[model samples]
Target: MEGAVISDEQVDLLLADTLEQYGYDFTGYSRASLKRRILRLFTLDKALSFAEFRYRINNDSSYFKRFVEQITVNVTEMFRDPMFFKTLREEVLPKLGTYPFIRVWVAGCSTGEEAYSIAIILKELNLLEKSLIYATDINPAVLDRAAQSIFALSYMKQYSENYILSGGTKEFSGYYTANYSLAKFNDDLKKKIIFSTHNLVSDRSFNEFQLILCRNVLIYFDRELQHKVFGLFDDSLEELGYLALGTKETINFSPFLKKYKRLGTEKIWRKIQK
Candidate 1:
């Protein structure tokens, strides 16, 4: 309904039903952000009230998948916040070189662009051979797209610009070949990356990592959930390992605040030695 006033109780009921029926947890997400997304979903059909939408969510298995997709934000890009990548190249990668092998975890990697960007940087720095990247997200749809490694050809211009700004030494086009409407990234880059589905809200850390990039994904979460995920990251990182967050996120208020030391001006943090 165009003018339907969905109550807070309705949203809570919907989230609770989603968790109970589908086992997907959205209870820890920021209320306002979740509300906006849910309203946006409701606007997709003006005929359905919030209760009807909630019923559809509980009744239709297929629509449940779409509902999950709707609420989860997938906005991301290659070398997003170019300067952050630049710092990663200049400051972080060099330190990681001391390790014989490196493991990088890109959490909530939507549509694969972030993973591809990291692979490219590692390749440029001659570290790809020794690196294993685990790129994960909760959305199966985006994970498939990421595994395909084919982005819209139109996005190349912006991705290329981001690449250059992120200290790309060679022509950005060298990394991918363009078909008529899609740009296929090099298979070599994809080989070093593993794409999987990981639900940050409910899943535990699978492996220790030398670097964890959970960029831009935490902003959707409220403080309690943010701390939970931060704890997961704390456990996931090896001693002196790096943790990168979104530009707007910080470890300041986190319980693990003292466990990490901020690095330079980037949103990067280094795990403090015990």
Candidate 2:
């Protein structure tokens, strides 16, 4: 099945139907990215026609769940971008530790790897007891897996290397117990973390935070949508709070740019003005 089989009109129709019926808005998502994922799902599911694909997504609740999961990108790993975590450990977390209670929002935290990574940092810094991490994603299926505190054991070697590169001094294996093919992370690492569903497209800011990490998420949104989400993050972040983005993302063109000061060469910016 060629990707061209799914026409632009068909993609638009599917997005509209998804938003109307499920309240999951992908309308602001990058058309090329969305179309690509939709086409992939269409092929993988072996749908005979666009009509069958649309019908399954709209009428079957289970299929709709699968559609949401498939469309939304969920690729993530612990301590992704080691230097980012290294900066957090050496600079960001220290400043945040001064606060009586630290509140961190890991938006678009797919399957919880990054959330756990943050928890590990807080724990090592002795700030875990004083901190709360809200890990959220638009897809509930991923959120469910995140809440389980389990990840593929096969990825540990890479994750452990990332941890070491990120200035971790302890044995990375101490963080989780291997159970056959899966590794169950320590329950303590999740004690201060909360996993929930949040749609950046339509959800309102639920709380103000000292740090908000929405890395690699906005790249999937159109410029207009990216600005809207930046506004959402702006409203949810307290004065002097920090916002982190993926290496490919930046706030240079955002209306909020002047209000923030970039931190070093990393894609982190500290809010300098309320």
Candidate 3:
């Protein structure tokens, strides 16, 4: 039977229970999106009622993990919105080269595609040796998949196209090897990355960074949470550091709006030097 419609109050209760039991907070996410994802869980499981769904989530830790993964939204591709990476290559990376070393944080780095993209850029610029990339996501499952650096072979065609459009000089296929259904990226590219499970909702900044990319992540958050996260990014970045957001995200409504200066047409922003 199709699951009975889950009410907003029930979803809120689930979010609260998730926070209390798992310590993962989703309180600040957009209500509509949260509702959709939660409803999807019910539909996928053929859950008959909200009570059953809640009971399953509460009793089965593994089920809860899957549920968390479902709601987190791991949609991403390498060099997505190619112009953004193009701008990073042309404008941002050159300026960053002045620094003796570079630290980058790719928050919500699902499946490590974007992090790998950045590492490829650094490699091209001969900066990989002096760079450290911390790629984090709230879902441990995604992190595990990301650390494997093995993506579907089907994606390579699109990724290669993105690479070419993003101003890549070398053959994009050179970076990875295809093994049947999977494509494994070069081990050398993986060396500089550190993958970890990080809860951005409740976590504090652990280190300063010269470049922080949290693209497509803020849109899921409500205004108040977006502001809070912007403040966190502002605190985490070095003066004159770069912040990159998703194509659809903007800094106009942020409390820290004036603190960042947009660079060209790309979603790249720079912290104004004091």
Candidate closest to the true structure, highest TM-score? 2
Compose the digit string of candidate 2's lDDT tens values, residues 81-145.
99999999999999999999999999999899999999999999999999999999999999999
| Local distance difference test, each candidate | 0.91, 0.95, 0.92
Better of 2 and 3 by lDDT: 2
Worst 10 residues of 1 by lDDT: 43-52
* Cα-lDDT of candidate 2: 0.95
Q: Summarize candidate 3's per-residue lDDT along 1-274 as a digit string, tens digits.
A: 5545879889889999999989999999999998998888789889877888898999899999899899998999999988889999988988898999999999999899999999999999998999999999999999999999999999999999999999998999899999999999999999999999988889999999999999999999999999889888888999999999998898889878788899988888899963
Give the clash count for model 2: 0
| TM-score, cand. 2 vs. native | 0.98
* Candidate 1 local lDDT, 1-274, one digit each (tens): 5566777898999988988997889999989989988888888766356667888899998888788788899999899999999999999988998899999999999898999999999998899999999999998888998999899999999999999998887999998999999899999999999999999999999999999999889999999999999999999999999999999999999989888899999999999874
RMSD of each: 1.2, 1.0, 1.1
Candidate 3, superposed: residue stretches over 4 Å from native: none
**Residue 189, candidate 3: C-alpha displacement in angstroms:** 0.6
The TM-score that candidate 3 achieves is: 0.97
Task: For model 1, name the residue pairs that clash.
Answer: none
